[model samples]
Target chain A: MSLGGDWYLALAAIVFSIGAFGLLVRRNIIVMFMCVELMLNAANLTFVTFSRMLNDIGGQSLVFFVLVVAAAEVVVGLGIIVAVHRRRAGATADDLHILKG
Target chain B: MTHLVGPLVATTFVDALTFTVAAAIVLAGAVGVVVARNPVHSALMLVMTLFGVAVLFVEQQADFLAAVQVIVYAGAIIVLFLFVIMLLGVDRREVFGRENLRGQRPMAAILVVLGLAGIFLLGFGAHWATGAPSVAGRANAAGPNVAKLGTSVFTTYLLPFEATAALLVIAVVGAVVLVRRTPGARGPDDQDDAGLEEHPGADGGDGTLAFGTGGEASGDADDGDGGERGDLGHDDPALGSTHERKMTS
Candidate 1:
């Protein structure tokens, strides 16, 4: 089967947009984090698709770095979440307006 | 004969169908993250979404990204979220608030639609078809998956790699320091003291004052007595005479 076309790329883009919507509109912090992951995965999907389409190793290499950044993001973001939870007892992202200035 | 080829073709078709189903599940879970009310439940749904995406990645021949997505995103990060949820003793009722801003949700929906339209237009409508060599040639020629990634990361991208490590170290140190209570930090210790007082007669080694009125009086007595023995019980109505006996004896 011939692979790497615009259809799957469009689908990934739409999914990523939904995720961005969730990240924007959602008040819950953890769900927002999940949404962020969704967006990242969408980008990764595009990268892999294009990598296959072009037969370039660079896009795949970039996917590796993106994965690395995503891991680091999870580590740091969850650490912040835990810190906020410990300090506030329950870290609702809505409650994160302590520094709203 | 042709009958044997039919079974093999059927198996491959079934595998494709299975992969499609997995992809659908991942998409649904992404939607669930947006729609779910309970943050904990949403986080759990996100784990399913991540798993589905990993399957899709595997289907796309991105084995490394798939494993990293599952292991790092689903296993470690989501578990950290669950741990925080449990540790903070978050009640379900406390998480949801019924306050939709004026026209915010609809506006957000509209913006998302527009952004997606833009991306689709750019992705599909744009006439930029630059075909390079086919994947088969590269896959046959390179023959080293992890080694290629490692070489690029170490040699060409080494500076950024080390910088990322520094960033991670800083993040770890910052989170640790943020969560850690200093020796004299009053808030966390005060809460712990309140918890200690909840279980009356428990051996709180630091002699934390009890919570209520009698304990307040005891605290005052201890503060005034200039470092005497049995100071915590000195002002208690029950222990007053016993302390006096000890002082006289």
Candidate 2:
């Protein structure tokens, strides 16, 4: 038998926390996006864990959809980042104040 | 001691060892992603974490997910991230010592710690998996992992599967539209127009059209400027008048 489900859940929680911390603290938009990926991966791990624990294929199916959404999000997000970089050469997340009215 | 530890540890030694090693790798990579000053290093660390997760997926009998995780997350996603990083030339090391907002780092750390503690408490204290077992299908049913997953996707979750296909198409189109450079399009900073006009040769004479860089001159030659007067003839008349004034003075 594999290890208890709680072990995987605890690990996922910790990884998610680390990702959240990085998202909040990091200034660079790219690093922040990486943090979002980390969080999503952690959630994926949790889903797989529950899939095994419950003997349900639905959890894994949800993970598949999540993977698709993540890919779409990354594509659009990186395109936006490229557009932003073109406008201001070295602009960080803090420097994006064009919408401030 | 045997009775207390028996339920927690895996019955097989290999199972326990694999979980221990992969969990360690995942945690270490996650921390590295957060701490690495360079975005490239963070992306590499994310790959490591993804690989470790894939290993765990295999261990949990999620063989199809394991392969997809490796191929999609580590392969395509990380390469795209590195590509963007290199293309934008933002791979330089970031200064982590300086904090722009006062007490923001500490506050974020504290919030994450509290949230983690809450998750742990809620998870262990309550019954975690309280649901009807195998609502869609049994994961442990006697079949190959891929076949089982494919059957479920095509039968039970067909609508969502089709929706994801549409989502992917939309994402592709959206990315192209966002990154595409339009001629005479003004950004928030209007100063780039002056810079491009002054140094037309710097951008190879077509700087005003192609993203203000003049890297390529293949598409949309209708507004392509042949000389100084052509430079002022932008699609936007207001912008054209502004360029005319700048050229005259």
Docking class of 1: acceptable
Write candidate 2's Cα lDDT for B1-249 as tens digits.
013244554457888889889999999999999999778899999999999999999988899999999999999999999888755546545656767789999899899999988987777566745676576799899999888889889899999999999999999999999988666687557453234333334534543433422211111111223101222222433344334334422
Candidate 1, after superposition: displacement of residue B44 in Å?
2.0
Query: How well does model 2 score by local distance difference test?
Result: 0.77
List, in the given order, the native-contact fraction of each candidate.
Answer: 0.37, 0.74
lDDT accuracy of residue B90 in candidate 2: 62
State each candidate's clash count: 0, 0
TM-score: model 1 vs. ground truth? 0.72
Where does candidate 1 clash, by residue pair?
none
**DockQ for each numbered candidate:** 0.32, 0.54
Candidate with best lDDT = 2
Candidate 1 lDDT over B113-169, as tens digits, reads 999888766665565655755432343135566565566567767787788788778
For candidate 1, the per-residue lDDT at B228 reads 19
Clashing pairs in 2: none
Q: Which ten residues in a row are the worst by lDDT in model 1 chain A?
A: A1-10
